[model samples]
Target: MKAPTNRRRAIAKALTALLPLAPYADMEKIRAEAGRAHLHNLPPTIAVWLAIIAHIRHAHTDYEKLLADGYDRDSARFFVIEQTNIVLTRWRATRFLDADDESE
Candidate 1:
């Protein structure tokens, strides 16, 4: 419980630092969800970047649908990589993946 609280604080601090710099209108929701995700399984070590990636995966790509279709995690992510990167670029993310980039 205490560890989860620390993780949430870490995510909130990251969101506070990053949200003002980004142009997202729904950043508050993203930040909130990211914190929840961190508690579930999303790594808190790189919370901000993972939060952005989660946003793109859910919002801009068919990643969840692909997973539901029985595609493995890496495969689903692979299928959506380009679309994910496009949204990453739109968000001014510094780390856009090339098609040839190793996903795992």
Candidate 2:
């Protein structure tokens, strides 16, 4: 596998620097869960940020209410999903050539 691009390194660095701000109830548990979820295949630093995002989103229950609101929920969820997809796609495209790439 190829080395990660400088941009990916920078993003991972920034994400690590911002981890203290994640609203995690128990960071260790979240990290453990992330590891258990088999995210170790990702670059260690990038995986940390992904885990943080996953934990934050998992802990946020407000989405349930939005989801129950029918049309409004559908629109909001669609917007969020699309935005997330775009961001992830861009990140992957500019960073690692493949999801299973082991190079950091």
What are the root-mean-square deviations of the candidates from the true structure over C-alphas?
4.1, 10.7
In model 2, what is the error at residue 48, expressed in angstroms? Answer: 1.3
Q: Write the per-residue lDDT of candidate 1 for residues 1-104, one digit (tens) a residue.
A: 23367776777666655444455565665666666643456565356666666777877799999999999988888899889877766666556666686733
- Candidate 2 clashes: the total is 0
Give the number of the best model, judged by TM-score: 1
Model 2 regions more than 4 Å off: 1-17, 21-24, 68-104
**What is the alpha-carbon lDDT for the whole of candidate 1?**
0.67
Please tell me which predicted candidate would have the highest lDDT against the true structure. 1
Clashing pairs in 1: none
Segments of candidate 1 deviating more than 4 angstroms: 1-23, 37-45, 98-104
Question: TM-score for model 1?
Answer: 0.61
